[model samples]
Target: MNYWLFKSEPDAYSLSDLKNDNNSTGRWDGIRNYQARNLLRDEVKVGDLVLFYHSSCKNIGVAGTAKVVSAPYPDPLQFNPESKYYDPKSSPDKPRWVCLDIQYQQECIKFVPLPLIKATKELDEMILVKRGRLSIQPVSPNEWNIIMKLGKLVC
Candidate 1:
C-alpha cells in the first residue's frame, strides 16, 4: 500500500475530529489544488496508510495515523452551490475534483513536531522538510518508519 501524508489544520479538521467522527471515518474533501486533487484521484487507494499531520496550528506536526478506507470519488460538495468547495465549472458528468475516505488509526503518543523532523538527518530528503506546501504528499517507507518511531507509535 502507498504511504501518504495528509495535512489538515487542527482548527478545521484535526485528528481528534476524525477520531470522533462516526466510526472514526470521514471524507477527506475540499482539495482544490490540481496537484493534490490528481494524487487523490489517480494515486491514493483503499487500504493505503496516511500520516495525519496537523498544520497551521500551534503544534504543527504528524499527530497520528489513518488508513484510507475508500477509493477516490467525486467530491459531493463540488456540486453543492452553497459549499465553499463548489465548482461552477464541474458537474456530475465531468468532475474537476475528487476525494477519499480515511479512518482514524492511532494517535501519536510523542507528537512528532515539525522542527524535530526537519532537524533529523535521516529525514533530510523528506518532502515535508524540502517542499511542504502541498496539502497532500507522498512519504517514503523509510521516512514513514522513522516518523512513526519518533511519534512513539507501533510501526
Candidate 2:
C-alpha cells in the first residue's frame, strides 16, 4: 500500500480526536485545494497508510499513524450550505471534492518534531521538508521508514 501524510490542525481534528472516534475511524474531508483534493480522489485508497501530522499548533509534527479505511467518496459537506467547506458550484451529480475514512493506528512513541525531521539528512528530499503547504502529501517508502524510525514506531 502507498504511504501518505495527512495534515490537520490539532485544535480542529487532532490524532487524539481520531483515536476517540467511533471504532477510531473518521472522515477526512474539507480539503479545498485542488491539488490535495485530486490526491484524495484519484490516488489515495483503502488500506493505504497515513502519517497523521499535527499542523498549525504549538507542537507541529507527525504525531501518529492511521490507515485509509474507505474508498474515495463525495464529501458530504460540500452539499451542505451551512458548512464552511460547502461549494456552491458543486452538486451531487458533479462533485468538486472528495474524501475518505481513516482509522487511527498508533501514536508515535516519540513525536518526530518538524525541526528534527528537517535536521535529518535522510529526509531532506521529503515533501514536508521541501514544500510543506500541501495538506496531503505522498511519502516515499524510504522517507516513511525513516520517519517511523525517528518516531520510534515499528514499520
Candidate 3:
C-alpha cells in the first residue's frame, strides 16, 4: 500500500474527531484544490496508510495515522447547495470531486512538530518541508518510516 499525508485543521476536524467517528472512520472530503482533489480521485485507495497531520492551528504537526478504508467515490457534499464545499456546476453524472474513507490507526506517542520535521536531515526532502500547503500529499516509504520513528512507533 502507498503512504500519504492528510492535513486537516484541528478546530475543523481533529485527529480525535476522526478517532471518535463511528468505527473510527470518516469521509475524507471537502478538498477544493484540483491537485489535492486529483490525489483523492485517482491515487488514494483502500488500505493505503495516511499520516494524519494537524494544520492551520497553534499546534501544527503530524498527530497520528490512519488507513484508507474505502475506494474513491463522488463527494456528496458537492451536490448539496448548503454545503460550504458545494459546487454549483458539478452534477451527479459529472462530479468534480471525490473522497476516501479513512479509519484511525493509532495516535503518535508524541506529536511530531513541523519544526522538528524540518530540522531532521532525513526529512529535508519531504514534501511538507518544501511545499507547506498541499492538503493531501504523497509520502515516500523512507520518509514515512522516519516520521513514524520520531512519533515513537516501532515501524
Candidate 4:
C-alpha cells in the first residue's frame, strides 16, 4: 500500500478528534492546493499508511500512524455553502474535491517534530522537506521506515 503524510492544525481537528470518532475515522477535507488535492483524490487508497502530522502550531510533528480505511469520495464540505471549503463552481456531476477516511493506528510515544526530522540528515530527501509547505505529501518506504523506527516502533 502507498504511504503518505497528512497535516492538520490541532486546534481545528486534533488527533484526539480523529480517535474519538465512532469508527476512529474522519473525512479529510478542506484541501485546496492542486498537488495536495491530487494526493487525496488519486493517490490515497484503502490500507495506505499515513503519518498524522499536526501542523501550523507549536505541536508540529507526526503524532501517530493511521490507515486510509476507505476509497476516495467527494468531500461533502465542498458542496455545503456554509463550509469555507465550498466551491461555487463545482457540480455533483463534476466534483472538484475528494477526501478519504483515516483510521488511527497508534500514537507514537514521542512525536517526531518537524524541526527534529529536518535536522536529521537521513530525512533530507523526504517529501516533507523537498516539497516545502505541502500540506499533504508522499512518504517514501525508506523514509517511513526511518520515521517509524524513530518513533520507537522499530520492532
lDDT of 3 by residue, 1-155 (tens): 89999999999998999999999999999999999999988898899999999999998999999999999999999999999999999999999999889999999999999999999999998999998799999999999999999999757
Q: List the global CA lDDT of all models.
A: 0.96, 0.97, 0.94, 0.86
Candidates, ranked, lDDT: 2, 1, 3, 4
Off by over 4 Å in 1: none
- Candidate 1: tens digits of C-alpha lDDT, residues 1-155: 99999999999899999999999999999999999999999899899999999999998999999999999999999999999999999999999999999999999999999999999999999999999999999999999999999999999
lDDT of 4 by residue, 1-155 (tens): 98899999999987888999878888788888888999888888899999989998986889888889999888888899999999988878898988878898888887889888899899999988776589889998988988898887642
Pairing residues by index, what is the TM-score of model 2? 0.99
In model 2, residue pairs whose N, Cα or C atoms come closer than 3 Å (at least 3 residues apart or on different chains), thus clashing, are none
Task: Tell me the tens digit of each residue's lDDT in model 2 across 23-139.
Answer: 999999999999999999889989999999999988999999999999999999999999999999999999999999999999999999999999999999999999999999999
TM-score of 3: 0.98
Q: Model 3: residues >4 Å from true position, as ranges?
A: none
Candidate 1 lands at a TM-score of 0.98
* Quality of model 2 by C-alpha lDDT: 0.97
lDDT of 1 at 118: 97
lDDT of 1 at 54: 95
Measured with C-alpha atoms, the lDDT of residue 105 in candidate 1 is 99
